[model samples]
Target: MLGAHDSTRDAGRAQRWAARLAWPLLGIVISLGLWALAARYISDVEVIRAAFAPQAGLKALVHLLGSGELWPHISTSLQRIAIALLLAMAIGVPLGLCLGLSPLFARISGPTFQFLRMVSPLSWMPLAVMALGVGEAPVVFLLSFATVWPIMLNTAAGVAALDPAWMRLAQSLSATRWETIARVVLPGCISHILTGFRLAVGIGWIVLVPAEMLGVSSGMGYFVLDTRDRLAYDELMAGIVVIGGLGFALDWLARTISSRWTQRGKQG
Candidate 1:
């Protein structure tokens, strides 16, 4: 009986994986077909043959990868995102905690925060460049600014929603303020923080592509521009694919981390 049950479970798992894989493959095929159809209408024979064909894009991807020309751009973009995310967390968490803990502060600053958050990150690029001078500094600033709102708002909401009973219990235990915040508050709010971080990462990454196009050199965004200027549409498409792949991987990592954290929280 046990062996039969194990076999059934294994089969189910295999089926689920197959289904997951199949849908994406189906989508890719449909997309390629559409591209091919569109390519037929293009006036430029070379552009149609090279840029719009899936095989051409794949070849370009392979060539770029084999040549290792995309590595520096990838690394630079990754580093910028890492630094910007860390900066957002450092600034956002404390602000969120404060807003969460204090009703007066929340009321006072909430409108202002919402207003600032509504402004597009791109609008600030010119100002950032003027103030910071053209380099990674402005990119970091724009990304950090763009990403901070989600983290801050999520953190604040989590803190605000924490159980009053938890606070009472900590008070009864005579926990120090710092002790309560470190042990009780932070742990209780971690799931929310992680949720915020996930959102911040996604937002930051999307913004990072454009942010990289700023005065700084060597990033996926810069590569895209370079390819465009050089009229390498196939290579440009390849870069887009690389960006999408990296973004997907980052989101998957975040989801995995969030899931594990939730499971651990439940277990504890």
Candidate 2:
């Protein structure tokens, strides 16, 4: 009797999940249909010298995967993003902490940081290339430049939002400056830091393709350019799909981590 009841409960739960997923599945179907239509329309264009329909894209993607041609590009792109984010975090976290902790420093640097943030990271391409030279250095610099602002801003905001009571408790405990920041401030800012990191990842990924185009030989960005120049439009489309998938995965991972950390912090 208990076994039958548990089976029934599982079936009901499965049905509920299917119902919840129905609209999203429908949306995916609609999007695929639209993409197919667009490919068909592009095929009919006389001047478009590429056979890049949905079929071509699927074939190219499959070929790329089967031949292991996509792996290197994917790895390169991931590596650059990882390095750039680490560099951004290293720089942004300290700067952000300073801004949050010192009123005088914040006042002095606020306008400068804002002005710098307002400038497009791509605009630094020439200088980055010139100063850092071509290859991965320039690409990493550009991505880090684009990614750092959000992290710094978010960290600072998190610090600023911290309760005075926490600070008082730290001081009351005779926590040193480093101890106060390490324990009280940084812990409190974990959620904000994660939020900023999430934003930074988005920004970095968006800038990555263009940054990779500078002088790097391998990456998704370079793959796009190669496919374009070779008139391999289907491969280009496949590359686009890969990029989107990777970005979505990264964003999902970041959100998951952030949520878990936030929940843990709250519970603690």
Candidate 3:
């Protein structure tokens, strides 16, 4: 009976995996078919074909990979993103904890945060350039600024939602302020923090494309513009594909980390 149950579970898992992958594959096939049809029938097929044809774009992507021309752009973009995320986490987590712990502070600063957060990151481009100058600094600043809000808000909510009994228990045990926070608050709110981090990564990556277009010479965004200027439409499309694929990979990694943390919390 146990063996039969195990077999059934394995079969169910396999079925789920099949469905998960099958739908995306089907969608890709349908989309590629439509793309090819458009390339075949469009009035300006010659002009559009280089950009629209998946084969051409794939060929360009392969060429770029083989030639090693894309590595610098990829490295620069990834480096900026990593640094921005780390900066956001460093500022946001501490600020969030403070806001969560102190109602008075939250009341004082909440409106200001809301106002600042409402402003689009792009709107600050001129100011960032003027202040930070034409370089990686402004791009990193924009990415960090855009990502910080989600992490901060989610962390604050998580801290607020932690069980009051945990705090009381810590107090009863004569735990120090730091001890209570380190032991009770941080652990209890880790799931929320991870969720926030996942969300921030997605938002940050989306912002990063435009952020890179700002005065920086080497990044995916610059590559896109460079390809366009050089009339390498296929390479432009290939660069776009590279950006999308990298963003998807980053999001997947963030999701995996969040899932693992959630499962660990459940087990604990």
| Candidates ranked by lDDT | 2, 3, 1
Best candidate (score: TM-score): 2
Instruction: List per-prediction Cα lDDT, in the order shown.
Output: 0.90, 0.92, 0.91
Best by lDDT: 2
Better by TM-score, candidate 3 or 1: 1
Residue ranges of candidate 2 with Cα displaced over 4 Å: 43-50
Give the Cα error of residue 234 in candidate 2, in Å: 0.5
Compared with the true structure, what per-residue lDDT tens digits does model 2 show for residues 32-98? 7787777767756644534566667778899999999999999999999999999999999999999
lDDT of 1 at 63: 96
Off by over 4 Å in 3: 1-17, 37-45
Instruction: Write the residue-wise lDDT of candidate 1 on 1-268 in tens digits.
Output: 9999999999999999999999999998998888777766765687556585777878999999999999999999999999999999999999999899888999999899999999999889999988999998999999999999989999998897799899999999999989989988888898899999999989998998888888877999899989988888888879998999999999899889999999998998
Worst 10 residues of 3 by lDDT: 42-51
Better of 1 and 2 by TM-score: 2
Better candidate by lDDT, 1 or 3: 3
Residue pairs in clash, model 3: none
Which portions of model 1 miss their true places by more than 4 Å? 1-12, 42-49
